[model samples]
Target: MTGYALRKGLTFCRVDGRFVFLDLPRDRYFCLSPIADQAFLDVIAGESPAWVAAALRDGLLRETADDTRPVACIPPAPPRGSLHDNNQIVSRTSVLGALTRRAASRVWLRARPLKAVLDRVQERKSSRAGVELSVAQISRLAASYRRAGMLVSAHDQCLATSLAVAWQLASLGATPHLILGVKLHPFQAHCWVQLGDVVVNDQLDAVRLFTPILVV
Candidate 1:
């Protein structure tokens, strides 16, 4: 694995009292609470991971919000050859368009003000039963759609689509279960989202494509 500092276009910040960084041109993101962030910085600064891990896992903030994540520095661009011919034949199943549509759909679906569904689901489980859809799931689906979207000339790989999905779902009072991964290849590292055992809306078979850093 490449050293954290060696990672290109890497930017860090303190968010919601947590230390976090967003890797650009690639789609990966990472976070740490105040204490945890210190540890990671320490590790990047030459601190030992063994000791840092011990301290981090002992007692610290367990969860971080999506909106609180570090910002993306480098935005995405259109695929190569997008402006080549005068054909102007647009594809409907583009990756970017699909992600946008899926993310928007989740937001619209949640705004129905359907208290009956919430009431019934909570009655069956707990107050949090069906309050919201999983952010991880949405991210995955958006990714899949984006892949299709890209193929159909609808859109290209834009990291913000995943961020939008995460933000929208969180705003709807939905449960957030996100597992993020970055594919650090020769060209760039791309990010992907995952839920329990499923890769949501994966454009390609994520299992066959990405190498996971953490499964969440």
Candidate 2:
């Protein structure tokens, strides 16, 4: 009997008694049936595929030849920008804008649905035509977010920071890319905002450490 293993980079969360799987590489999510969920759990516990096959009569736990290879989901590279620029001038208006965006982002991250937030981000990105913000402008926006304490005090960490940054950028008629990445071995997950290849909310060196699972 061939051996089987749970696919790598597959993270799951339980919602309403059902297991919702997040296929990180593909950026797809789906709920598993009770039987399939059980099989998956068993495989994750290091049980042999033959043992799992006994319970899953439909052969849902069949072994695959390429079990160790990592999945890739790279998107077309966007235009790159400089990592460093002159500090943005902090004005009363910029401060007020950051505060408003931070408050809104906090509420949206908590009260709104994940799909809804993603949809809105996509809509904003698509709606903006040829209006791209320069590196200095993005830097200034990020600085405003920092001054408003949006980046440091967010309870949701990277998610909140990314959302706040994206929101602020969108309001300024600049589209920013939201990226989700995962690191193996230690199993770390991070989200950040970017404009083209330029890291917006976080340092580029830090983001380069993880493999991007989703870019939007």
Candidate 3:
């Protein structure tokens, strides 16, 4: 009898036969109970389910126009079967440049709203036309960022490092996809950069462990 969409600011994804949601502002992922997941499935399947009221109470879905169709936000999947390159000779200049970008990413994340910062990423991804990077060049960019990430004092958090990598590649004319992935068993979230099927920021073996939920 009704239609719905993801709650404002939430991105919807389906991973491993389950519904997954990313709340960027809250910096968390939301998975549904089996009943709610089935309700959402039915809703998106274009059926009006009586059970949707239960999902509404849970706050992940909101009312939409009756005719609106809710669809999953499908991001390009990381090339899990491909190996991540780490062979480039990293230079001090590359390290410095990446660190500078990383600092900027950190500051922007702290000073500006997360949506505003992500808006910049979206802007770069959309507006920067005519920029093309070859496979080798992309690998070099990833290598530089990986080396720079190693030197940072912060423990192994991936957000800032991944953002810097995406920003650097974009500045160099490569519009990179900054991917947000999650896994459920132990519950983990990770971020990485990719161009098409080539995963630039992390190893495929490690990258395969998570399913991409959002890409920006």
In terms of lDDT, the poorest run of 10 residues in model 3 is: 77-86
After superposition, which runs of candidate 3 have C-alpha atoms over 4 Å from their true positions?
54-59, 77-84, 153-155
Winning model by TM-score: 3
**Which ranges of candidate 1 are over 4 A from the true structure?**
1-155, 176-180, 184-187, 212-216
Q: Give the per-residue Cα lDDT of candidate 1 at 10.
A: 49
Better of 1 and 3 by TM-score: 3
Best by the lDDT measure: 3
- Give all candidate RMSDs, comma-separated: 14.4, 8.6, 2.5
TM-score, every prediction = 0.32, 0.61, 0.85
lDDT of each: 0.39, 0.62, 0.75
- Give candidate 1's whole-model lDDT: 0.39
Better of 1 and 2 by TM-score: 2
Model 2, 193-215: lDDT tens per residue?
87776777676667766556566
Q: Is candidate 1 or candidate 2 better by lDDT?
A: 2
